[model samples]
Target chain A: MTTKMFDRIALIGIGLIGSSIARVIRREGLAGEIIISTRRAETLARAEELGLGDRYEQSAAEAVKDADLVIVSVPVGASGAVAKEIASSLKPGAILTDVGSTKASVIAQMEPYVPSNVHFIPGHPIAGTERSGPDAGFAELFQNRWCILTPLPGSDEAAVAKLADFWTACGSNIDTMDPNHHDMVLAIVSHLPHIIAYNIVGTADDLETVTKSEVIKYSASGFRDFTRLAASDPTMWRDVCLHNKDAILEMLARFSEDLASLQRAIRWGDGDKLFDMFTRTRAVRRSIIEAGQEVDAPDFGRIAVAKPAEASQGRD
Target chain B: MTTKMFDRIALIGIGLIGSSIARVIRREGLAGEIIISTRRAETLARAEELGLGDRYEQSAAEAVKDADLVIVSVPVGASGAVAKEIASSLKPGAILTDVGSTKASVIAQMEPYVPSNVHFIPGHPIAGTERSGPDAGFAELFQNRWCILTPLPGSDEAAVAKLADFWTACGSNIDTMDPNHHDMVLAIVSHLPHIIAYNIVGTADDLETVTKSEVIKYSASGFRDFTRLAASDPTMWRDVCLHNKDAILEMLARFSEDLASLQRAIRWGDGDKLFDMFTRTRAVRRSIIEAGQEVDAPDFGRIAVAKPAEASQGRD
Candidate 1:
């Protein structure tokens, strides 16, 4: 067994991300004790029933009183409120962080209330399935995934390193970037994809020409791919949109502009132009798969052609 | 062994769909003789090396000469030429069909060349992985999938029944509809999704703020989902765009207009509107999952949060 890294770890907002951290911390023995806290009484009760923590607190303030590591996993829009609530009760020299998707907004919201003695680092783990909630987490969610930390200027170096080490122990690779850069990168990769997916699914849902039944039945062709991202937690995504407006708007504008050009090509029957863009984008898919960020076994990744089974093999 | 249903079967394109038909036919013993032909000699040779057919021909005309069932699985744009090439050689009373994604344009292209003696029907199986090649086929590819057949006016009922039965035997449920309706259905479910996927992936590739490496590394968050569709066969998709122009452009116009409204909501921080759209889309995902068109597995398809493993269980 490994030595415990923290005497007490306090988890604020026990949702998918928070509960996942709880599971990994327990699995890795990263903390001597875990204190779980969330605003929802039912979710807290559920977490307690699941034995996700050694202690449960009904208030965020009470939860952080003696915690050496405090990780807030609430929606970004809620960051300021949670930060203020726990500010007076935070342990001195403890590392304080969050698992929000938008870094700049989260930092702006939480950094002000954090005590000078506390290390306030902004973080986003680029891992999660479409499911959300306290029950929708697993210890393996962070395996081979990336955890990005945006440390503010003059932040304690030892605290940042400790936070990074904690994430590494949870089976995540760590990268540190400027908060603004992290926001921009995430805007294009996560935020825009989810927004586009949501928008397209909404379009299909609102369609007058096609039946919803047809869309559902034939979704395997392509539409279902967008549906997975579109089905992500609404409250969390709405917070992401409101918090990262500038970067998301910029990415959305670019995506719409590119889509307009593609629509024009289709109207004019420009097959070559259409083919070039479609083919070039494939290199990025290959890059991601090679980088080990995507499943290579075709799990909607790229169904590598298995050998064609002949006469003696196949299901009826 | 199952009895052969046709004296001979001719497949005019040796790509993913066509090779899959060959594999399934061989596995099920549905054809006494399988004749495979493609314009590309390299692809034809690969099909032969894989023993995907009982016979091979360089000319599509030669392939169809004695065949009782001819399946034209070419790009929609090339449907006219293949139909013209093999029209004279098609056996009388034989069933002729094509597996292009767009049914209306394919009918327009191939109908004029079909002889009076042949039963010309258009079909599209709503299935496939991102991979495409003569080698990327399995008999199980069509299991539980939908295959829509668009029969022209005065089509022989017996022929349609035969074709439907063939697809059923190959492990697909068959639906027949008007050509225009099939095109419209496919536009929303298949064509628009591919275009949007290609567009977003293209948009991410051109971003100046987010490097390609950044996009690749953090893709698991959402971007990788779009890449799977974007990496699909470009030639097939370009034809889908060009041939299904009216319906595709219609969907795109609707999509862009809806996106503008969504954009406005985001710009104004209309959290309720954003939340409503995001929440509404989850129903569609749930419907698709319940329809069994999608994997119930969390595989990028909603991780159901396996019970969080404790210290006694889990990888380090």
Candidate 2:
């Protein structure tokens, strides 16, 4: 095992991301003691049952009492509450961070209550699946994914390095960015996509003419892809929508404006405009594949093509 | 093998769908002879090199001659032109169909040129990956997928039944609907999703604030899913947008309107509203999975979870 980064690490809100951190910390031996805490008693119980941590605390405050590292992994909207709860009990010189999607809001919510002696950094891991809860997480979720850290300008470099090292040990590539830029980047990459997916799925569900069965049955054509994102944890996404209001609105406005132009092109039968937009987007997917952000397999390698039991095999 | 369903099957457009048809037909022994054709001579040559058919012809008309079954798998906008070109050469009593996404437009385009004695059924197999072209085709492309047929009233029932049987042999479940209804269903299920995907990808591409490399690097959060659909064949999607203009416009209107309300909720910090919409959409995804239209795997089962080499097991 690698060297331990902290004597104790407190995980507040044991959801998918939090549980994943617990698993990875154990796997990598990053923390001497892991403390899991959640607002919901049942969730804490579930985490205990899953053996996610060395200690279980019903109070976020209690969880951070002796911890050298405290990571808030709750909904963005709950960051402030979690921060306020743990503020007084935080150990001096402890490094505080969050895995929220919106860095600016998380910082805004978390930084105020943090003790002057504690090093508070805001981080957003650009990794997740649509699944949520402790059960949905796995140790390898962060492998080959990005973890963006938005450290305050005056924060201690040693504290920041220690936190970055912890994430690197969890198998993520690290990038540091300004909080606002992180928010903007995430608004387009994460928030807008989830919002659009939820909106489209809701629209399809509300259709009067089309039956739900028909939509589900023919979903493989394109709709099922949106459904995967739409099925993501609602509470977490709602918090993102509420917390990252400005950037998400900006991205949404741009998206709608571009969509209007596309709609106009369709209305006027401007095939060239449609073709150009469609063609340009293909390169982005290729770039993503090239960047190792996506799997190179066709259809993300989801389908296993069935071969004929016996056939004249020389055809292809 | 299965009894031969036709004397000769002509595939007019050896792209993803057409080439898959060729592969499946060869595997199932559905046709005694397979004739492949494409507008591009290179595509025809590639299909021949892949041994996708017994005969490869650059002329759609030549490929359809003496063929008992002719499948035109071209972009929706090209349906009319292909129908016109192959009209004189189409064999009497032959079942002719085109696997185009927009059924009403395809039917309207191709029906005028179809000979009265030939059965011209419009079909769409709701199965494909982001990849296109002859090389991307596989025999199991249609396995467990829905194939919708929009047959004109007073069309030959025997020919329709035969075509349905052929698709079944190709591993597709069949559904018959009125052409207009099919268009509306596809507008929601297929067309709208692709349009939304294209629009979002275009919006991301045009962003000056976020670098393209950053977008590519951080895509796994959610943007990559949209990229997959947006990266689809440009020509085919362009045709879909142009051909199904009315239905697409209607769906787009609804999508935009719903998005506006969602945007407002975010602006007003209405977490309850956001949560409700997100929570409701999750059920639709569950329904799709239950209906066997989607895999019930988290993250689409794309990422294999890496297990710790040693850990206390039996947690689940």
Candidate 3:
């Protein structure tokens, strides 16, 4: 693992994930030279100020030229455009990947634009914070997180392994699945949560019954939990919703169906049903904690640290 | 300010809220004697072990005997029964109050049992964690939170003010609203969030398509945020659902409608609509932060300290 995985690694969008990769590449010496290209002039300037790359270019084509590895870490909706911008200049056999939320859409948007000479492997590093932009990223952002790669069928296995190794070096565990499965799983795990968060926050905003002041003052009661997800990069989430339409809709249908049943239980005063559903859900939280995906508290990733009382433990 | 708010304070149901009030009573010396009562023997013993009260009793009637103030901190469904148990034992001119989520239902259920000699006031402290039971309480649990009182018409203003004063000493801001309005507001802000979290987590749990391990491992992507609310006390949440049916239903219906619209937007690739919603919700988070109601993170209240990255405010 000497610092020379590739002679040049090009990052086409220096936002949260992109700048994060830049930091890790710099720290781990993963690439001899890091070329950064972003659409926004300010962002490019900021990345340069942050010393995020060895070379900064406004043109994606210029950044990708002669680069052995090129990662387009833009929003899913921009994948096609970025792919098209850099495709002609991509070096032969160069591995081109993306860090997008929706895989099927990213593949669909980017696949046709990728030249046959390049190894086009779509990827999603399931790591981020609510913040965005070049300054919001850090080298340790991907630590212990999951990165899923949806390489095309009949694609070179060696190329896929190489990308996986790159993510591994950046502190992520790698997993592979079909793009469709990835979309469905993500619809439930990532996309749905973000959508629900945005929806609930919107509902609160439109509320006339509860004064806006009251919603803000009493948010810690539970409403605030959704706010962080709700406050994520609007452009990115919008793209996620637009790109992963069918899977997201399917997940939303299932979610609404389950919600309707739960609502029925509440309406009928079915304590047993409510209790059963609530109790069962607790197990999933515990499993997530055991699997190291979540912390073992009702308020994870917050400023308050509550110690669990032994006597508070019940069967549920 | 000197902490002698009542001659004696009886807490009838030493769960999280009950024990929290008890802790505050002890810390502030607000009561000459703190009498704690719950139906469960184990909980009573645990409260005694924790020194949460000056006296521990299984009978609500016995606990209320000779007490000048009584706080019924129980599930909404149990409010009537607890009121009945302590009705005869309530001292004349005593201020009788309750900490129930659904103020309207609690008032309806318990109003009949409160004798004319006692001043009955219903209040809801908009603060809690997912954990419950006597041992899960702390004196500062209500600090900087909202404590809403929904008093019946023509109720004793002095008694209501005194209760408000007590909550203030425990570090909560006070708000007064109609009982039905309080329930509706709570339905949207708290009840619905819990229900949705429980429902979504349940749906993910029942998915046969995605392996449980995959869901757990990738949960950090977003799904883990829902688990904290889903892991909240089952009995308390079940009672809330049953008692706050109308308000919860109203909010749930509205939530569903909004979600359907969002789904339609996603399906139609309406990125602008999604972006607008996401952007609007960010303002709510900002308001909550300014109101000091929430920490600036998704999984808040779980961690004692935020990462330094959160403090600097630059990353995504």
Residue-wise C-alpha lDDT for candidate 1, range A1-316, written one tens digit per residue: 4758999999999988898899899999999999999999999998998788999999999999999999999989999999999999999989999999998888888888989998898899899878777877778789889999999999889989999999999999999999999999999999999998999999999988789999999998899989989988999999999999999999989988898899889889888999898899888988987898875444431222232222112111
Candidate 1 stretches with Cα past 4 Å from truth are: A300-316, B301-316
Please give the TM-score that candidate 2 achieves against the real structure.
0.95
Clashing residue pairs, backbone N/CA/C < 3 A, model 3: A131-B316, A132-B316, A135-B314, A136-B314, A136-B315, A136-B316, A299-B302, A300-B299
In candidate 3 the C-alpha lDDT for residue B289 amounts to 72
DockQ of each: 0.47, 0.47, 0.47
Q: Which stretches of candidate 2 lie over 4 Å from their true place?
A: A305-316, B305-316
Estimated TM-score for each candidate: 0.95, 0.95, 0.93
Per-residue lDDT for A63-92 in model 3, tens only? 999999999999888989988888899999
Better of 2 and 3 by lDDT: 2
Reference contact recovery of candidate 1: 0.77
Listing every candidate in turn, what is its Cα RMSD in Å to the true structure after a full C-alpha superposition?
6.1, 6.6, 5.9
Please report how far candidate 2 places residue A251 from its true position, in Å. 1.0
lDDT of 3: 0.84
What number of clashing residue pairs does each candidate have, in the order they appear?
0, 0, 8
lDDT of 1 at A12: 99
What's the CA error at residue B15 for candidate 2, in Å? 0.1
